[model samples]
Target: MASGQKKKWVDKMVFRAALRRWAQAARASHRMELSELREHRTRARRLRAHLDKLIHVAEERLALPMIGNQAFPRPVDTDWAWRPELWCGPLPVPGMSSVASQSMLGDEATMFHDCAQSELTLRQVRNTREADLAAYGLRMDVFRFDGSYLSLAIDLPEEASRGLKRSHLIRIDTIVEMEKPLEIFARLNIKHGPNTEQIVRELPLHEADINVEFDLAYTKLNEKRVEKLWLDLIFEGPEMNQVVLRDLTFSRRKRAAL
Candidate 1:
């Protein structure tokens, strides 16, 4: 064969070898892309399935007996966006009240962080409500040995808690240890969007369980919103005495929710 022809044939063989390697690389890349697409679709399908289950659970809870009644009150039904495990279910008996609650050091629910002020102990905890009693009724066991023992509850207002600058009422029920007759103070923590303030008032002059309810007709709210709130129960008297708080609950009326 002529030398020039032989050289041309060798060049053609090299070109064909390079073309085979490029084809193999292209096929591998295409397979990898297809596998990734499949994985993404699987993940999306799982997420959608989970969301469906959550929605179903929320709807079921809204159907429970007297879901929005006073004692067994229902959580605020916001728009269908995020759902918390705390909301969708037959609520574990409200051992405290319809909404937020607080107790002294040894009291029920959970002990407060500060110990320098008073020492509170949990005496008993009730999870169920009696037929003759109110909703989410709890018999919280609490006794104060060093300082004042205060238990508080804050109930949310309607209108999605919007345009409300302050709490509608401050309710206090206390069992105090009398050392020359003590005095207790109750404060309402109200927040409206960016503004937060404390509304404080002293308890009645007496012993035993003093049930107090404050009206919010005085506080002004203009295009306000309430997202969080609480109450502080303070006792003023001799530092050493024992006080007991039995039933602390939130409601529209003095009677318990059925």
Candidate 2:
């Protein structure tokens, strides 16, 4: 063999031997005595810290940019557009099982239910599809759901309600995939000084893309007293099913006067 090739092969064999030795030491760490274990732990922690940094950098450099990109379509006359933080980036806590009522997944999204025994899971997964614009997606799995009510509430940013008026129309677009047939409703709630206005629309699951619009002209909304806005996604008969929300977006535009 060439000298250069032999040197490379020797280096690889040495690295493999070192890795095996470290693995054996880690496997036997549990049997170590208290003082010895403490010493071993200190060294292991230092080694782990360096390894973690290397792994983190390697993953970030090699993987696609899937954490912060938020680009989606909007109406021609749209004044504002938004994509919730949960769908635009990774959450600090990504997944939860046996979720309780009023559990929050991130700063903007919350899970609510009335089940006596919780059998639900919520996870934020990377959107690998080429056509997907959002960086992340939310996946929900339900097994033997006995809840009387189930909903996922997302708090809209303050900008959504800023300079609000009665002539504006709010639109919601989403891409959802379900393992079986199910019913879902999207409700928009706007809180004013002392009252709240709500509008509900059923999602057409049969369609490839789901879209709904709420015309503020129809609601008795106090434009001057608008304080906050939010959305609730209610699900019916979600038992023994899996649902994936690939993307969700919001936009606002002025309604044409009659």
Candidate 3:
């Protein structure tokens, strides 16, 4: 072998031996005397400090351009695009069970339901698929949903409504997987002065890439009074199903004037 390759192989073997020694020490730590245990603990803590830093850096580096990345295709003439916080990075609280109505997963996403008994779980998981653009995904498992209405709401950032106008078209793109056939609807709610304009579109689950567009021209949107906007993903007949949302993105573009 070349000198460089031989050196690397030697270093790898040394690393493996060191790790095995540490593992043996850990396994025998329970039987160690107090003095020896204290000494070992001190050394272990020092080693762990360096190992933790290494692991953190390695994980961040391995994630590459996925974490905190918001790059996605935008429609022609599009001026704004956004991916929710849940899909961009890890959440402080990643998973929840028996989620209550209006429970929020992150700063931007919330779950709502009227179920008498909460048999649901929501988790933010890493997306490892090669084609997944977002670093994270959301999984929802519903064992027995007894509610009449269920929806996961994502509040848009302020940028989405900034410089708002009536001639813009908003679009939603989602990568979703389901354990079984389920009907889902995308609802865009724009809250203006004392009024909320809503446009709902059923997702084409049959398609591989689900995309929906909402033309603001049809809504009675008071562009001047536009304050906040949010999107609601409503699920129909969601009982006993597992749904994974791999990625979701929103974009806005101006429509040609008549």
In candidate 1 the C-alpha lDDT for residue 112 amounts to 36
Predicted model with the maximum lDDT:
3
Per-residue lDDT of model 2, residues 156-228, tens digit only:
9999999889999999999998999999999999999899999999998888779999989989998889999
What is the lDDT of every predicted structure here? Answer: 0.44, 0.91, 0.94
Give the residue spans of candidate 1 off by over 4 A.
1-120, 125-180, 205-209, 220-223, 252-258
Off by over 4 Å in 3: 1-65
Worst 10 residues of 2 by lDDT: 61-70
Candidate 3 residue lDDT tens string, 148-201: 999999999999999988899999999999999999999999999999999999
Considering only N, C-alpha and C atoms within 3 Å, which residue pairs clash in candidate 3? none
Model 2 residue 74 CA deviation (Å) reads 0.6
Output the better candidate (1/2) by lDDT: 2
State the weakest 10-residue window (summed lDDT) of model 3: 58-67
Supply candidate 1's per-residue lDDT for 202: 79
lDDT of 3 at 70: 92
lDDT of 1 by residue, 1-258 (tens): 899999999999998996786566556655667776577557658866987999998776444423223333212431111111112223443333211224432212333323343433333322232321222222323333443344433333343244332333434443333435566677766665687556677767563445665556565543346665555556554234444442344332222323
* lDDT of prediction 1: 0.44
Task: TM-score each candidate.
Answer: 0.39, 0.75, 0.77
